[model samples]
Target: MTAHVVQRSTAETTLMRQFETEKLSSSPRRADAFGRFIAGGLPTRRVESWHYTDLRAAMRDAAPLAPAPDSGAIEDARAILTDRKRMAAWRIVLVDGRLVAELCDQFPPAVSFSREEPSPVDVDDPMVALNEAMSVEAYVLKVADGARVEGLIEITHISTAKDARSVYSRVAILLGIGASASLIESYLGAGPGVQRNSLAILTLAEGARAKHVVLVEDDAELHIESRLGQLAAGAELNDFVLISGGALTRRQLFHKLIGPEAKITLGGLTLLDGKRRSDTTLQVVHAAEAGTSREYYRAIVDDEAVGTFQGKVIVENAAQKTDGAMKSQAVLLSPRAQMNAKPELEILADDVVCGHGATVGSLDPEQLFYMMTRSLDRDEAESMLLEAFGEEAIRRIEDDVLAEALRRPFWAWLARERVARVGGEGEIHWVESAS
Candidate 1:
């Protein structure tokens, strides 16, 4: 097999040129966004936060921008949102960067909505700039203060491109004080060469409660980058993400505890095989006193797949009594498989407890053998052991249905493992849990 290059390509210059050609009918904010994109270019491994996953080299060969499909089969892909119980809650749907009004439900009557134009962030982020410059539609959702939506709200992003395509999609959510709801977002696709840039900004008012879940399962060849921001005071935010498909994917999440006594919990699961790659990077800020945060991530890597996790927690001087902890574990299924994890904590406040842990290893053969000796076959024993390993972190999922659905891809991957010949397999069978 040819080795995958980890070097930057000429696309940085090419992407800059392509952005210049488009007569950007952008506002000052949008123009600033474009400027930031050009300034930051693409994130590289050299950047401390992006040291594990290098987009400079991974996306260097990406094709030029393409238009969204005029019309193609989009119904089948809609299965990601078919649950009516969940469908009755969301107020927005963006299909390949464009709004799909027909499939979107209604928002609470007390809430107001608008998508006038794209706003610029102060940071010089190339990906953010690209998304702001190229995106055509924006979905904005707001929940009325003191209101409660008992059902789950789902935001489905479907890639309907037939061939090579590029899309920029954006969404903004705001929850009023004392309001409570569950939000679900999914990235689904059915094409060969499609790349997507997506962003979501979420705000929680004082004393509000919100649970957010993201599921990314698109074409194995699709490239995806998503940015999510959360702000709350005395509010609570719980985020859970499950990533199973994508040629290359990264989800960057930022959480700001702006109000005293606010709490946040972040949890996720990643299952990859073959040469697939997924990165879940996060940054949490304890900007207020008595704020607390916890994060845990588990990854199952097989084949020659690569997994990266970069987590950072910043505690401000005024943020006393802050408690933060992050832990990550990866089970490699192949000798060629790779996993990199970095957990960082920066504190200026005394009187706080903060710690992080990271571990990388393969399944223990002794345990496997012991299980098999109990009358179970190799396949059954391996599957059972693997499930037990993942369940440790998966049990944290608040929703049982979501947890079961997250296990489907893993079981399927295990079922496809070559059981006839054990010696023929490499240290980590790309098909088992490692590549």
Candidate 2:
């Protein structure tokens, strides 16, 4: 018998060595996950799910794994979080992907926290498997049964190192039966080549309710955030995400309904400028009877930026009377801007209502002109229109202050730059030339 050995890339070799040095290879779970990753390799454009992002090509060389932030980096994070401190009662901080116990507030009686390894899923995705293999520690958060918490629980992730690096973080949240809470996940950092991978697993017991919000702030680069969740009978989730900056950002979500009368509402808003690229992909499964799901996503792209949204809803034969709908809309602010939307519905059930729709277009000239005629300057009108468009989705958020905070970065960009800069198409002119 002959044995064949596959070759590994420079980054893969470095990571394998790091894994051994860190003694991660000693764990059977991590070893198995790494094996799966080695077999699948990195996802490329050939894979339909990754056709647009092309992560394998985006990352030509693997970066060194980010380590625990030093004292200097901790202070940097504290300064960066000054404004956000008011947004939540308790904040969980992760610097360079390592948890900072001193910065995190004491948990309430309804909540408990622990650290352990994340459970590997059945999927054969390289990113997922890599996260499992690379993750050094995972946070476990549990809510007491029937406990209703009023304040917000915020998880803040910051990367302060200047060198090219990568970090993996894992989080698991369990909502006990009839428990309720508000959770926020915020990602913020600055670097040209820093890469981050995060995996989150959420489980909602019967009658549990949760509102999950994700905020991707400015200066982030090469970020991948994936979420997987299961909902039990009468479970309800109001989930939302707002992305304002990143060189390359990908948000992937998968949600499954395991019991009857499960309801979920999903919304997303992305703002891209310069040459940034952002992709939001999601799938919802209706495996039980009387499940309901709704998804609405919107994006604004400027300059040479690119934005994409891919959403899918599947209704199984056993999921009778299931209701699902998804819609994606984008507005291009420059001629060179690009937006791609793919929304799909799959139904193997006879009695179900499901539909999906997508739209991509430029700002309405007529609407802008009308606003100008009403005494508003062209730039002011444009800003107002953009804010109004974004506010639609923000209005649906469960937290009023959080929604307002999410809008600041978008407006800040508009205020700082020339809104009428010449670009691929629909270029705005600041002054009329004497002809």
Candidate 3:
């Protein structure tokens, strides 16, 4: 009998060594997760879900684990946080994957936070297992039952690693029955060679409502974020993600409607420039009757950048009268830019309505010419069209404040795009006016 040995990459080998030294690996759950990751290794193009990204090939080697945040690093993070544009929200700070108490703002009576140990999840992905094994701690936020929070609860993750390193963080948000809240998860800073893995879990009880916004604008070389959500009967959730930074990024979303009459809206906007690559993959399951979902995504690819979107809507056998629609669109600004989109629908119930569509094309030359004739320069006209293209997804947000806050980053990215189009010589700046 011949035995076949699985070949491990340098990054996998490094991860094994790091796991051995970590204190968290002593727990049985963590040990089991590490074993699972070792067995499967990193996902490759051969994996249907990861076919477009090829994470195993991209991660040639892994960096050392980031150290605990020291006083100097905390001060630097504080300065950065202070300089950023202020929004009306309650802030929680995490530096180098560790929560900083002094930097956080006081929460209202309806909201509470605590530190908890990472628990086992039902997800089958290797990356999720790795996060479970390597995460130092999990931050848990709970909204009291029937409480209506006034402002957003923002979790700001600041990476201050000046050298090549890896960081892992976990967050869980639970909303009680009849509770309503808004959340913002922002990723900022990190050296050019840093690698980060972040996980967020959301659970909503019956009659709960939530709005979630994720902003990825860090300088990490490799960034991967996984979001898991479960909704109960009569619950509603709206999730939006904006990707405009990082050299290589993959965002994964898994959501399930576990109870009848649940609703969900998933939207994303990706801005790809230079040689950056961004991939957004998602799966939504309608497991109960009369559930509703809408998935809309858009991307702008320029230079030699590449963008990928893969989404699937599943209607289970018991999910009668389920309604779902998914659409993905992209505009390529350069001849070398690339956009790949794959949308799928699986229906087991006869009374379900499910469909998906994808489209990729370049900007309209006639529109550009028309805008130019109206005294607008080429860059200005292009920016206007691109803004309108991306705004469609943003417009789905119901909250005016949250929608405007998310728009600031989009406007900033467009300003930078304009600068790159003309010449990459000047310092790009964008200021929000006091309207």
Which candidate leads in lDDT?
A: 3
lDDT (0 to 1) per candidate:
0.72, 0.82, 0.88
Estimated TM-score for each candidate: 0.87, 0.92, 0.96
Worst 10 residues of 3 by lDDT: 426-435
lDDT of 3 at 221: 94
Task: Encode model 1's per-residue lDDT on 1-435: one tens digit a residue.
Answer: 226643335866666566667655445655667676656567787877677778887774555565543444346445545642353344466677777666676665755556745343343356766778767677677888998877677777777666766777887778889888787777776455777788877778899888887777676354556555555678988888877778887878777888899989898888777888888888898989898898999888888999999899999999999989999889998899899998899999998999999999898899989988898777666667677776666556666555554555445444544342253342332222221
lDDT of 3 at 263: 96
Candidate 2 ranges with C-alpha deviation above 4 Å: 1-9, 83-85, 118-120, 417-435
**Please, what are the lDDT tens digits per residue for candidate 3 over residues 133-215?**
89887888899999999898889999988889998989989999999999988899877889999998889899999998888
- For residue 69, give model 1's deviation from the true position in Å: 4.7
Regions of model 1 farther than 4 Å from truth: 1-9, 61-69, 73-91, 108-124, 220-222, 408-435
Error of 2 at 297 (Å): 0.7
Per-model tally of clashing residue pairs: 14, 2, 0
TM-score of 2: 0.92
Q: By TM-score, who's the top model here?
A: 3
